[model samples]
Target chain A: MPKFLIWIAALAALIALPHGLSFSQQEILVFLTINVLLVASYRLLTLTGEWSLGHVVIMGVGAYSSALLTKKLGVYVPVSMLLGGVIAALIAVLLSFPLFRMKGFYFLIGSFAAGEIIRLLWKRFRDPFGGAKGIKGIDPMPDFSVGFYQFDFFEPTSYYYFAGVVVAVCLWILWRIEKSPVGLTFHAVHWQDKLAQASGVNVRAYRTLAFAIASGFAGISGALLAHYVGTINPNAFDIDLMVFVLTWAIVGGTATFYGPILGCVVLTVINEVVLRELGLEQMRPLIYGAIMILSILFLPNGLESIVQKLTKRRAAGGAPERSPAE
Target chain B: MLDLLAQTGLNAVYAASYISLVAVGLVLIFGVMGVINFAHGELFMAGAYAIVALYAGLNVPFFLAVAAGLLFVGCLGLLMEKALFRPLKDNPLGGLVASIGFLMILQALAVMGFGVRMVHIPPVTQEVIAFSEKVRLPVARLYVIIAAIVLLSALWYFLKRTKFGWALRASAQDPEAAALQGISITQTARIAMFIGAGLAGIAGALTAPLVSVNPHMGHSVIVTAFIVIIVGGVGSLEGAIVASVAYALVHTFVTTFWDGVLADIVGLSLMLLVLIVKPTGLFGSADRA
Candidate 1:
């Protein structure tokens, strides 16, 4: 009953949180909400024990598909976003044939190569992709009203609330998937592919499934960003952004479901709120870089381990710690 | 048409020279330490910055600046070994992340030291060795080609003939066994890092005056190097060189005939093809992958 109350309080805080912030903070909140989904989806892919460098590109696939569908085909924004994820998943499925042939370091490099090819294609084809400048003047989410509150898409707070709900639902689905039998198979594939294969677990199929599902969620995150930001270029989804996602995953630690989410939130708070307030805009990357190195060197297991330790201590004291799913 | 083709061919050779320098160093480091140095491109950028400071800013002799670039960047590599790679030796992924952090730090340092704009270094020489109306090779480019050949030959000799070279190769093959045989892994790692980083540094220094120098200039160079090393087969020095030449030829021709963006696409696609057909790379043994 206490756990349920905590969940209600947290959701209430999230709902009311953006209201207390300035306009810019609200904007950052919207992005943070989207990024939580992005990083969470990244953790899903990592669960299969293959770290791909092409994830951002797959996200781009979602953005581009959604944006094009709305602009050219006159599809509704929400439906287009869903189709965007489907397309991204389909692309991941196609890419897996070429990419999954290798493992470990080879997979990393190969995925990068595949992603670069996709970005170049976007750059080369000016007709649909708008060349290097990318698609601009994207359709925004249309405003709607419930009995209690009216959603004004133009306001950052409205978008934040919208994105938060989407992310919360997405996180719920992801948590469900992770706890399912399929998720167990993914873990099996990650730990020992040979043993899993011997035990009738189709290692390749599970890997593909994880990749597809992860890409689907990543696509949704991209779609959310596209509608909110109203612009995205080939350069927007480049390796620099990919590096940030990687840093979040590593710093947050991927052992638990909430690890990357914790990483994304904390780092975003540090980078956006703290750094901006301090006016260290130019030195941001340097400071961020130093933080990354220090964390990897000292906190190699990531911030999640710290959480785990605290939880374990609490459990030992007879008061059970909160479940990560909550 | 033939003259144009000849000009592009010469251009390709020059491109091949500097690319092989960077790719070979990356391969050497990966071979010995088993860690991909993501900061390698930043090291190349540092080499260029060395020239920008010494040769261009201080008006020192160009050759001296080039030499300083090599030494300075080589020392940077040693620092990386001591500070980052050494402690994280058992964790390849951790080492990779650390290198990325290091890469960001270098890039930020460059940005702070030399703003985000491109730095214009005065040309070392304007003399063009013209073979025909269309075919021409600048003396500056000749310097890069000659230096690549000389330095690579010296590296080959060092690896093939020297006792330290034997130790480096032995450690690269199997660190535990090599250590058991009394070859110090630390000593070999330092030497490999130095030579590998020095090669990249020299390549950057040689090409600095020819290309626009900037903090982010390493981005494309590292990408090209990655493609070359992957195509050549990881851990194979000879394969890196060969793949560099082949990649340069294809990329230069595509750029000449089509466009730069198309050329990049062709290069990446070629890499993907190589990866799909042979995950271990074109010249790599099956066990390496």
Candidate 2:
């Protein structure tokens, strides 16, 4: 019943991931892992009330930077991954200097613009990143070495488990941050920045750190995706992905830790499992649209809250109205 | 150089038309509902695909099909409000998340209904308006330009003259005050969604034959719409139009002169420039942020 149980269960799910899934289906679910990791990371930054529309752009920066460095400059994959995260963090921190002056929605808009700039730069450097065609066949992800258990990087189930593990690790790191004093500062900023500042919290410092940390994890997701697919396309890093992740985090319930996992898993499974099976072909969006509408209509608290209510109702006949305190 | 400039100018006109239509709808929704409709581009895509189904597949009259596309997508927006945004009224973030979910649903539906391939929305005209031998504008492009002018003007007139339009604006500017005066938030949101979505739909239907009509086509427009809204200043209807033209001109000219890759750079740089100088956007007032 601990959070660690969820991580263990996810790891078990990954081990059996490919039992029935086709190569393509496994591919989509793996992509969902990437989405889950990034969405959770995105929710981390959103805790401080710094909503970002350009996080996917940060992901692209990570993906392309690691990709191009390894492919062209002959850098090692692990080092390249580290470099990607570091660069993204540096960029976010530097950009936050001027952007931190703006409060509320203005900061959000500024970040969106910054993301567009990143996308443009990637496309502009066609020779390096393969432009629209994107860099093809980056160095394969090195085999993860653990004592005597060597996991092959080429297997679908292996990568699925790898993605699962990474997501779980990221989730734990995010959980740690949420429980840390920094988390309190972030929630304070989100709730009331003026009050937080009056209480001597360095609002700007915590805000920048939150945004940078999210970007760093996004970089990891991007790097993993690039290495997993062995191909990188500019299209994959487009603004639409950011919007999708934002939706996942929100619908999952940004206020709760488990919201994104539910948003990514449940919605994705529906999108894939139902939409694909019905072969509603192109018409599957109606089902998705209907679900979103209904989710918001009947349960504005998002899917996470729905899960909470269902679980609570089973435990007791009625649910309380207040948030359970930390 | 003259011919190249001429071509870029014509390109700007077409870009401006479509961008303005999409941006205006975005502005209208933002103004009234106080929620940024992330699915605005998908609504636009739905409009184009509507044309693909009715006009191209079912052989409906082109103009009537276009109108149907507008009305249908507009209804979809209204449904979104009643079903999604209305219940999450106090939570803008929830509305946003709902929209994100809505986008996936729309994209999936398009894939089911139309398949993933680009549907052929028959060209309205093959004629070209020649500015010179080396430079000409397609009649289809002109249609877009004309549509932008007429639709935007009609919107302005309605806002300036009509009772309902005033009611809509009043609700947008101050919902609580409007509520005090007996103007229903639900009614105003419905009106805003209809017009906002109708504009995006019509834009899609009109440009269907001109651009590739695929399930993912909304992706670019949404980003472009965001950039335009940001540059124009979010929640400002007039700001959207002016910024759209400015963005289109800059985007088209760069695209024409260099490559799309470079043009994107210049466009982002322009957005960044605006952010540094006027964080509220060119026309956006300080309070909206």
Which prediction has the highest TM-score against the true structure? 1
lDDT of 2 at B143: 86
Candidate 1 ranges with C-alpha deviation above 4 Å:
A317-326, B286-289
Query: In candidate 2 chain B, what residue range of length 10 has the lowest lDDT sum?
Result: B280-289
The TM-scores of all predictions, comma-separated, are 0.98, 0.88
Instruction: Please provide, for model 2 over A56-118, each residue's C-alpha lDDT reduced to its tens digit, 9 standing for 90 to 100.
Output: 988887888888889878999878987887777788888887677776566677777777777
Model 1: per-residue Cα lDDT over A1-326, one tens digit each = 98899999998998889879999998999999999999999999998899899999999999999999999999999999999999999999999999999888889999999998999899999999999999999999999999899999999998988888889899999999988999878877887789999999888889999999999999999999999999989998999889889999989988888999999999999999999999998888898889999998998888997988888786665433323210
Clashing pairs in 1: none
TM-score of chain B of 2: 0.97
